[model samples]
Each structure stands twice: as structure tokens, then as C-alpha cells.
Target chain A: MNAAAAYLTSFLRASYRDAVAGWNRFWFAPTDPATLAMIRILAGAMLLYTHLVWTIDLEAFFGPHSWVSPTANATFHEVPKISEIMEQDPYRGRSFVWSLFDVAKTSQQIWAVHIVALVTFALLTVGLWTRVVAVLAWIFAVSYVQRAQGALFGLDQINTMLAMYLMVGPSGACYSLDAWLARRKNPRRGAASPSTSANIAIRLMQLHMCVIYMFAGIGKFVGASWWNGTGLWGGVANLEYQSLDATWLAYWPHLSAFLSHLTVYWEVFYCVLIWPRALRPWMLLIAVPLHLGIAFFMGMITFGLIMLVGNLAFVSPESVRATVSWLFRRTRPAPTTGG
Target chain B: METSSRPKADDRHQACCPWPNELRIVVSLLLALHVSAIYVGPFSMGAMGVTSPLALTLRRTYRPYLEAISTQYQGYQFFNEPGPSHLIRYELEFADGREMVTGKLPDIDEHWPRLRYHRHFMLTETAYTLVSRTAPPTPPPGLEVGTPAYESWRQFRDADAALSRAFLKSYAEHLMSVHGASLVRLYGIERRYPTPEEVVDGIRPGDKRFVSEELLDTFTIDIEVVSP
Candidate 1:
């Protein structure tokens, strides 16, 4: 009896150790920082551009006399049940968050805050003072996002998310003014070694993307239209959202069905298919066109582009470095000295 | 491509990576919490039950808070439900008896300018979402005068409907004022259109050409009139 108990204890200990070790290796393994930095530049540009869209009718959405007056906006935040789901008020700012809305009572103040946000976004894109400004950029993203809660959509939500995760790591590690400054400070040294920070950030993004797509795919089952392939038509047929009306596809029901089914299956199984190195290229091939199609045909250009950017986490760092090098005419950091 | 050699602790330029076992454990825990924070929302909504006793208790306690935060981050259930789509159009009669009509608040120009105005329609859609997407409370059985639950719903309906009306009034005022009208009587309506497939399938009669404008609300702006 005593011998059997001792063997069981040993087996349990070994199993626990093995599990912990595997978890550590899977998540904390060092990875190159290039992909994350590239994502920052692209996503930051997206953030800047999205906020830039707000400028066309600056006060129409936020001013007291505007569409959503301050009183209505406050009701949107304070009212329970309705606001919780509909308004999507951020929990952190129930009482009030620093919106340019509060101080930008006048159109001049509104544009002033808007310009500062744009500058911050530009800096974040180029990776200047990233550690500090990334947080500031997040503040800007959140403030505008919550303030413009009425106008929010998939584009704003995902933009704010990428902004949050970008702040999690050393996102300025490459393809940035900060990266060049680092090399300038230590010119003799080759590019720095891969860090656990980059790996963790990429892992979180990958995981978060999985959650998004999985739920997005699953959510379709709730609707009768998705089952019948009518939901896909709904996007194009709705004249309000239609840009390049391909409702002509009504005659080609077979093609419409194929594309609709492809989207659902691709999204539902993305998290699994994405992990395999061999399937990675194929998944991207399907995803890029799917997103670009939405942008062009469906008229949700920013939302579609942001969705594509979310998939950028799956891209390998080496490819990012090569692309950057190609663009800048060999301006990237010297190839790494260590693996 | 990664280089042949590996980085060392005493490298010429330092790289800070928390590579210790304890730190990795901490990271694992943090990642787990973060992932869980996102997961619980879709799970609870999708009926992916947590069967374990401890898990169920923890979920029951923290699920509401997490649902709010998670939704704020990414409510990616876009187009999961299918229904009639609407566009608001307003017609205004100035005190001088001249009348004006506009597509909606956004009525933005073509190309890039249209993207900016998508927000106006988004606001209207949100009101529709609040009204239609939410499961209306099952009116409670006791109907003497004012049961607490019924009263709560009564208050909600008034607030919710009033909001929709208020938005119509405000935008109507602003848009009409732009047309050189000081005082205007405005009536708002929505054009309800069916999906392409709906028309093709004849879900109802006249689906193909079914374009009906539902009267949303009628109100006065900077002028006294009968309540609508």
C-alpha cells in the first residue's frame, strides 16, 4: 500500500511539471519584434484615419446643438439596460471620461483636441516615445471612442482593442524612429535578440483574434437569415450601406451561396486552421479578399480594413522585415546576429 | 530569418525578457485571466456552460461585470440577425409655408465624404437596436395598478421612445435651420426595405417592390403645435 501511494505521487508531480513546462514554451517562447512593430505602424495609421473621419462633421455628432446633444449623451450613459447594450458605454467612465466633448464645447476647441489626437496617432505610428505615448494614444482612442459612442461600429471597437494590446509590449522595437534611435545609440551592435514581450503580445493578439472570429461565426447561427444565405444578401441589398451594388448576384445564387458559406466556415475554423504553418498562407489568401471585398462592395471600408489588420498578428516577423526592407531600400536594422 | 546563434545574458546590448519560471507562471495566469475576461461573454450568451461547481459560482459572481467590459471591447456580432433595414427621411414645412425634404441627417456626398456620415445612420440603427434587438420584458401577470416590474418597464419604454423622438426633433431642427427656416414643423418617417433574397423568395406579397415609409414621429421645432 505504501509503495503504491508513493508511485501515484511521483506520477502526479511529473504530469503537473510537464503541463507547466509545455504552457511556458507555448506562450513565453522568444519571438522577433518586427511583426508587432509593423502592426503598430499600420494600426496606428488606421486609428489616425478613423479619427480623421470624425473631422468632416466635427460638431454634428458631439456639439450640444448637434445630433447627439450633451443631455441625450448623458442619458445614454446613465440609463441602465438600454444603454448597457445599445450605447455600449465603457465601464471605466460611467461618471464621465475626458472627452474633447466636455472641453470642446466650441468648434475651435473641438478641432484643437482633434489635431492633438491626430498628432499623437502620427507619433504612435512612427514609434516615438512609444512606452509613454502608447498609453496616451490609448487614452486618446478610448476618450474619442466613448465620446463618439453613438457613431461607434466594428471599426472603432477593433481599433480601440488593437490600441490596448499594442500598449502591452515593446511595440517600438522595429520599423520606427525609436528603433532607429536605438541602433544609433548602439551602432556597432546588430539588431537586438528576440524578446519575450513581443512573443506575449503576439500570443495575446492571436488569442483575441480567435475569440472574435469564433464568436462572430457562431453568432450567425442565431439568425434565420444566415442559415438561408439571405444575411449575405442583406449586406449588399441594403441601399444605405451599398456602394458598388452587386445585387446583380441575385441571378447567381450559387456564387452568393459559395461566398457566404466560405465566410462562415472560414471564420468558425480560423483559430484552428491559423495555427498550422502549412495552412497559414491559404487562410490569409481567403481572408484578404474576403475583407477587401467587404471594403469595396459593401462600403464598410474602414471596418473591413481594420478587420484585415486584426489578422496581421498571424504574419511572421521575417516577412514583415523583408517587406519593410523592400519599402525603405535596405533601411531596416542589420539582420539579427542571434536566433 | 533568425540567426544561427542564440542571445546570451551578457550580450553587448541588453534585452529585457522576463525569462524566469516564476515570471512565466505569472504571465500564464495573467493571460488566462485576460482570455477568460473575453471568453465568458460569448460563452454565457452562447450557452457554453461551466459545469464545475467552483467555476459556476465564480462565473455567477463575476459574469455581469465581465459582460459589460467584454462587450465594450468587441461586440463583433455584426449582422448576426436579419430584419428589415431602415433609412430615416424628414420633410419639413416652414412657417412661411415653404416645404423642404432631405434624405437624412448624414446625406453626405459620394466617395470619402460618405464614410464620415455613416455615423448618422449608425445612430439611427442603434435606436432601432435598442427597440428591436432587446427582448421586451414579458409583462408580469399581476395587473392591478403598478407592479414593480411593470412600472420599471413602463419607465423604460417612456425613456426609450422619448429618446428616439428627441433625436428626430434635434436633427430636424438643425437641418431645417440650414435651409433658412427659423421655425419649422417636421415629420420623420423610415423607409423599410426588404433584403434581396426576401424579394426573390416572396416571403410576403409585393416583396420585390416593397418600399413603405413608416411614420416615426411628427414634432414642431422653434414653433408651437399640436403634440404628435
Candidate 2:
């Protein structure tokens, strides 16, 4: 048993080292300017959206007593019964833990955290104080996730992983206001670090995304509802909550069951096989349709599209360009790099 | 002559672009895909136009509490319900000392009448059940009754199921008239009630059946209208 445990520990340590080294070589190698530029722009855009979306109110997303600010006091709607965890028999013993949140609920504490998180996310997007802002965003996001584990959706999970990845280096490497200003002040210092910094960040993000997908697929496998094809059925059944028409799905009685079975299989099989080069494209292809179906049938557009973006990591740069060129005839001029 | 010029230009471009042409093509494609995603992708994602009044209104209503809770809690709830709508939703308190409710409410627009009718009807039915269960055997002798007292129910003939049913319906209708047509409707309450026997059967002795037993306790009535 000790030998087995030691083997597992050693294996994990080796994988971590390999991951960091591989990421450095691939993502921040200073060879693929386009890849680097793409990463910067994409990450920036997502961060910008995260901030801009919050220009309204942040409390709407979570309850008054968030993990980030449990002492917050305010009267809002009851926190939703997100999981069977609360309803589970064993969990009854720990019911007091849940009720404690109600007694200490405060909107102020939540608001304070929101202010910092939003500002940090915005700064990170603009690449201002890049590393510091990245760490701050990660900290804030983790705090939020812990407050209501059940309330967490896919987008929050993805962003939390993103915060961790961005910690490795200055994501403000290109196309940032930070980069433009740096160029004017000192042109020689405009380039990204030749060290493995970006690679570390990008690799973590990629691995983090893989874990998310694998976990999601695993969750689906454990669910009888997903296997029965009614996993997506519950949303469509509630007409008041539905943003789109999904009554047709229920009409075909057998289809729901079939879909549930297929969904579970896809999730489980993809989780285990996604890393293989031979199967990666196929897995992504399947996921794209599945995600798209989710967007259309369940009104989960944001999450479905975000997952699609994550799957883009599996796509080779060559294929992505080919696909883009085929769709749009306009060719982008190459950037001029000094000899 | 054109072919000759094309080769020279191609050679010059090849010399300039050390990165594979394929790489440039792929980058452009990826950018286009991303840009397209921001456009006609799915749902109403990229369709938010600044000038659209509907969008603006939605933004105004939605924006007030978007930052109130952490993004960790993204779920729905009623505008004002007894409990939170979902596990993830949080309440927001503005600096001005007012509570802010966020998330979507059940769509009542399509079933407005049904919902309205049911709301007050259920309350009335519940009131009747409580009265039937807890009403004393008799009012105190020589006591003066108020306008809202249950005395009006005394005029009806007893020991007749039909008479009792009619009496209950009439009483409900009278309440509706007084409450205003907008406030009370018959469709809101189910006409059926559990018979005394059904209530008694539900009681398991030794269990907490005292509430049901108290409800089943017999009573006698003697009401008179002395004035007019």
C-alpha cells in the first residue's frame, strides 16, 4: 500500500513538472506570435465581458450570504434548492450549517467583494498590474465559489480556472493598453518573456479546462436522469422558466430515454479518451453539437458557447486557420517582426 | 507575362513571411470565428444593440443587482416569494437601505387570471377550514356580533348536505362581492374540501392527532338577529 501510494505521489509530481515544462515550450515559446496574440485577445475579451456584465448589480447572481461575504445582511429571495445534497438524508444532520447562512445574511459584505472582483477582472483584462490583478481575481473567484457550491454554473467554474492560469505571467503581453504604452516608453522591452512563464499559464488553463470537462462528463454518467435522456428534459418541462420552445422533445417518449443514455456515454467516454490525439477532434466534434443542442433546447447559451471555446484548445492552429479561411475569404496580413 | 510577375511577387512574399502562410491563414480564421461568435452566434447573445429600448429596459432592470451577489449563484426566483427561487440566488441590499430582489420570476403573463383567481380563493378556503376546526360550540350569551362575524351562516337550514354546500358557495360569493371582483374569484379555490370522515381517517391515535380531533369536536349554534 505504501509503495502504491508513493508511486501515485511520484507520478503526480512528475506530471506537474512535465506540464509546466511542456506549457513553457509550447505556449510561451516566442515562436508562435499568432497564438500568443490570440490568447491575449481572447482572454481579454472574456475578462472584459465579465466586468461589463457586472456594471449592473452582482448580488443578482448569488444570495446575500455568500462565502465571499457571509456576514452580509439583507432580505432577498430564499437561496434556491440547487442540489439533492440539501435534501439528502445524511445531510439532514448538518442542516444547521445551511441555516446559519440565513441568520448571517448580508448584502453589504457581498457588495464589497463584488466591487473588488469586478475591478480586478477589469484590470486583468486591460493587463494593468497584470500578475497582481490575476492573483486577486483568482482569490475573489475562489471565495465566491465556496459560498454556494450548488449555485456554481459552468461559466463561474471556467473563470475560476482562468484566474489560476493567468497567475503564471503577464497575460497583458500583446494588444493590451499596457503593451502599447510599454512599446512607446521602451521599444526593446515590448516582447513577451522568453522564459516559460506564458507556457506555464496556458498549460494550467488547458489542464484546468480538461479537468472541468472530465468532471462534468463524470457527473453526467452518475446521473440516471442524464442517462434516461431527461437530463435536459427538466428545464424544458417548466414552461414558465423556458426561454425557448422545447415541448416537442417530450412528444417523442422514447427519444428522451435514448438521449439520456447517449449523453451519459458521451460524457464518460470523452472524459477518459479526450487526451488522445487520434480521438480529441472527434470528442470535440461531439461536444460542439451537444453544447449547441443545450444552448438551443435549454436556453443555456452562455455556458454552451463558453465550453465550445474551451474545446477550441484541442484544435490545431492549422485546422483553425483553414476553417476560418474557408468561411471568410479575407486574408489577414502578417505582422512585421524586426530581423 | 502576368504569370512571370505573379511568381516574382509570390517569391518576395514567401521571403518576407518566415512564419508559414498556413499559420497566418489559421490565425485569421480563428479570429473570424471568434468575431462571428460575437455576432449571430446563438440566443440573443450578440444582438444587444444600445439603441434598442427593450434591451435598454432589460439592462436597467437586470443591472441593478447583477453585481449584488457573486457570479457563483446564477439561478431564478420569484419577484417576491416566501423562499429563495433557487439555491444559487442571493439577495442584495443597496446602500440606500432597500432590499434588491434579483433573478427571473414565474411567467404569470399567460395565466394572469388563473393565478389571480387562485390567490384569494385559497386564502378564503383556508379561512373556512380553520373556522370549521376551531369554532367554539356557542358564542357567549347576550354578546353583540360585529358585521364581519360568522353569524350570517346561521340563517341556513342544518342537517342537509345540499343546503350546507349552497350556503358555503353563497358565503364565498358574498365575500367576493365585498372584496371586489378584481380581488376575489371562484376559480382560485378548489370547490372540494376533505369531509370530516376523511380528516378523522387521517388521524392515527397516539400520533399528534390532537389538532384533527379538536377540529372534529362537536358544536351547537344559536344565532338571532335582534335589530331590523
Candidate 3:
């Protein structure tokens, strides 16, 4: 048993290291203002939008009369959301195992924490006091999720992961007022100017994203739905649960099953393939489409897009330059030999 | 002299502009679109594939609105003709005999307490009057059908649940604050990820005897929310 534990630990560590190395090769470009700006704004806007939708009374679609809410509670029934099991049910312990960490309370103190979270998200988006904002946003998001207990929705999980990623990345390095100010304070600092702090931060984010994907995939495998090739199909097909028909999946019902099987394989195998030198780029390319599918089809646009952005961490500067130039229709000039 | 002349060819080349361009505005627009899609996009469109933004906007702009016409207040029941949006009219009652009807308030001079609107759909003709001694005024018709009130109710429930969980946590710590741990004991439930069965068992204890099954019939999951 001890040997098995060691083997598992070693495997996870290898996976982690491989994922980081891939990220460094693919994603770590000499910090660009444009890329950084887009990431921060997108993340911030998503946070704000979630809060707005949650706070508003636009119940026409999700109201009691609408299909989602149950008028009278039932003992045992099919859940209205496919993600509910993955997102909420795992934590629905009967007794409070760790009550102090639980924020499920109506106390003024709890509300105060919520307010702080709202502020933290706002600050994190604008890149104002970014380091502090990142810390606070991560804390607040995790705490809010913890407070929601087992009732947490998919968005909460996504938000928690996003915050975790942001804490380790150069999320506030560009397009932020803070970044602009920092640049102004030190005009000579250029893209190639490396700071120990920023380097550490970026590396951490890359490592964190790898773990997130690997763990998520591992969790899916643990569930029967993934193994049976019914998870993705069920998610797309259920009427009360699915937000859209996506019934086009029926035309190639076999395709749906294939996709589900593919997802599980991709998740589990991604951890293995992400680290291999020859296969890393191909694996990343596949990941791009998978994430896009999630964004486009799952009403999980934010999560998909964010994960895609996180995948960018695997790209290297030279390769990125080549890719960018190719995308922009630019040709590289020939190098002069000892001019 | 020729080599010295080459030195002056251009110091300006060394000062090349390498700063990356700003994509903030474009990114911001895309983010805004992504967020708005939640409301305007086909409710199910999100679950399908990228919903058409144009279609989403059109649906939102053209969505129907429910309006309320009249309201009547009675002893334990409130009656209101909340215009066309409501399918069934409603009356609310309290255990203490205080009730409000669907119609207008008693005083016309004050606009604050007036019934603004009413609308309901997908609800049966049944009436529900929660007989709570401490319950606040049952939510109004227009309010109940809307998302805000429901979310508020969820928030309220979550907050209350949190408090209950906390109260159970410090069972030993608060022992001295009271007479002793013996006087007041709190048992925290140890449910390590509750299954559907556990949630049901917790809400409805099997020990209670029912006089008739008809009372229990109200607990059916298929019952729809009546909108008045």
C-alpha cells in the first residue's frame, strides 16, 4: 500500500512537472500589454455579470412557473441540472465536518464578507492594487463557494478556479491602470525586463492550471456517466436540465457517445500527453477546440474561454511569435550572418 | 574614418518601440457580449452552441409583460385581478387571522402600499396560504413570478441555513457561556455528501402519524406554482 501511494504521488508530481514544462514552452511570451488586458477585462466582466444576473429578479425564464424550480418539494427526483451532481452533491454531507470553514450563515459578518468579495472582484478586474485584489478575490470566491456549501452551482466552481489561476498569473500585468501606473513609475522597464516576483507569479499560474485540468478529468473518470459514455450525452439531451436542444446530437447519436468518451479520455490522458515534447503542441490544439465546444455549446462560455486562455500558458515565446506572425500575414526577415 | 562614420548610422535603431499594443477595448466588448448573452440569448441556446447575438437581442426586446388591474383585501385572504399575466388569482392568510387580498389597499391616498401589478402562468387553481405565526407577508403576485424575488428567497434560505450550521458548530465552545454543556446540547449532523435519500429523510421524519393521506398529497413534486 505504501509503495502504491508513493507510485501515485510520483505519477502526480511527474504530471505536474510535465504540465509546467509544456506551459513554459508554449505560453510564456515576453509579457504583452494586449493579451494581459484582454484576460483581466474578460475575467472582471464575467464576475460582474454573474453577480448582476444573480441579484436581479428576471425570473420569467427561471421563475417558479418556469421549468426549473419545483413548486412542491419532492423526496427523490431527477435533478434539473446535469452539472448539479458534479458541482454540488459531492459536498452535501449530513453533518458539518468542518464548520469553522463553512460560511453558510446569515450573520451580518457573513454579509460583510460578501461585500468585500464584490469589491475584490471589481478591483481585480480594473487591475487596481492587483496583487492584493488577486489574493482577496481568491479568498472571497473560495469562501463564498464554501458558504454556498453543497448548493453551489457550476459558476461558483468556475469562479473559484478562475480566482485560483489569477492568483498565480500575470493577470494584472497589462491593460490595468495599475500596470500603466507601474510602467509610468519605471519608464525604462520593457517587456523583456524580468522581475523575480512576476516570473514566480506567472510560473505558479501555469502550474495551477495544469493541476486544475488534470484533477477535473480525474474527477469525471470517477463518475459512472463518463465511463458509460452517457455523461456528455445526458448533459446535452435532458430537457428540464439542458438550456438548449443541442438535439442535433441525435443525428449522430453515436457521435454524442463518442464525444463523451473522447472527453473522458482527453481529460485523463491530457495529463499524460501535456508533458511529452513531441505531442504537447498537438495536445494543446485539441484542447483549444474542446474548450471552444464547451464555451459554444455548454452555456459555459466563460469557463471554456478562460480555460482556453489558461492553455495558452503552454506556448513558448518563439513559437508564439511564429504563430502570431502567421496569423497576421507577416514574413520573417532573413538573418544577416556576422554583418 | 569610414568605420567611425558607420557609428553615426543610427542610434535611433537601438530605441525601437517594443511595447505590445492594447487589446483592452476589444476584449471588453467581447466580455460584455458574453455576459449579456445570458439574458438575451435563447434560454437553451447557451447549452446548444454559440447562440446568435442578434436573435438573443430580438427575443429580449420583444418579450411579453404582465400587468395587474385590480386588488381586494379581505380578513385572511387577499384577492387581486393582476391583469393578463396571472393565470389564477390568489388569497393569503396567517395563523393569527391577519390576511391580505389581491385587490387594492384600503387607503388610496398612499401609493406606497398599493398593488402595482399581477401576473401568473403555469400554475393550477389551487391556493396556498402559509400559516406561519412569524412569516412575513406572502410575496405579491408580480413579485413571486419574477426572478428577483425567487433569488432573494434563495439567498434568505442560504443565509438561514448557514446560521443553523454555525449554531451547531460551537456546541462545546459556548458551554461555559450558558449554565453548562448539559443544559443546552447541539448535535452537528455528519453527512459526508448527502444523497437524495438523505435530504428527503432529513426533511420528513417517518415517525409522524398522518390522519389522512390527502394532506400528504400536497407534497407531490409535479404541483405547479399558481400565479395570480
Q: Highest TM-score: which candidate?
A: 1
List model 2 lDDT by residue over A1-339, tens digit each. Answer: 999999999999999967745533344343222233345445545655644454342443344322112222121112211121112222221211222234324666556666767777777766677667767766666555444332334555555555655675556665466778888899788455433354445444555455455444544543355644555555454332244665565556577667656656666566467778888878887888787876665555555666666665556545644665665655666677999
Ranking by lDDT: 1, 2, 3
Which 10 residues in a row give candidate 2 chain A its minimum summed lDDT? A75-84
For candidate 2, the TM-score is 0.45
Q: Taking the tens digit of each residue's C-alpha lDDT, what string does model 1 give over A1-339?
A: 999999999999999977865676667677888888988998999998887888776777766566666666655655543333332334422443345466667877777888888899999999999888788787788777666656777888788778888888889987789888989988985774687878888888888889889988887776677777766776776666777867777778877777777888888999899999999989988989988888887788888888888898999999888877787876756778876
For candidate 3, what is the DockQ-based docking class?
A: incorrect
User: Which of candidates 2 and 3 is the stronger one according to TM-score?
Assistant: 2
Please give the range of 10 consecutive residues that has the lowest summed lDDT in model 3 chain A: A73-82
Please identify model 1 stretches exceeding 4 Å from their true place.
Answer: A1-8, A82-100, A326-339, B1-17, B20-27, B41-73, B93-111, B131-159, B162-166, B169-208, B222-227
Which of the CAPRI classes, incorrect, acceptable, medium or high, describes model 1?
Answer: acceptable
Candidate 1 pairs with clashing backbones: none
Model 3 chain B weakest lDDT span, ten residues long: B66-75
TM-score of the second chain, each candidate in turn, equals 0.56, 0.17, 0.17
Reference-based lDDT, residue B58, model 1: 40
- After superposing all C-alphas onto the true structure, candidate 2 shows an RMSD in angstroms of 21.1
Say which prediction, candidate 2 or candidate 3, comes out ahead on lDDT.
2
Ranking by TM-score: 1, 2, 3
Best by lDDT: 1
Best by DockQ: 1
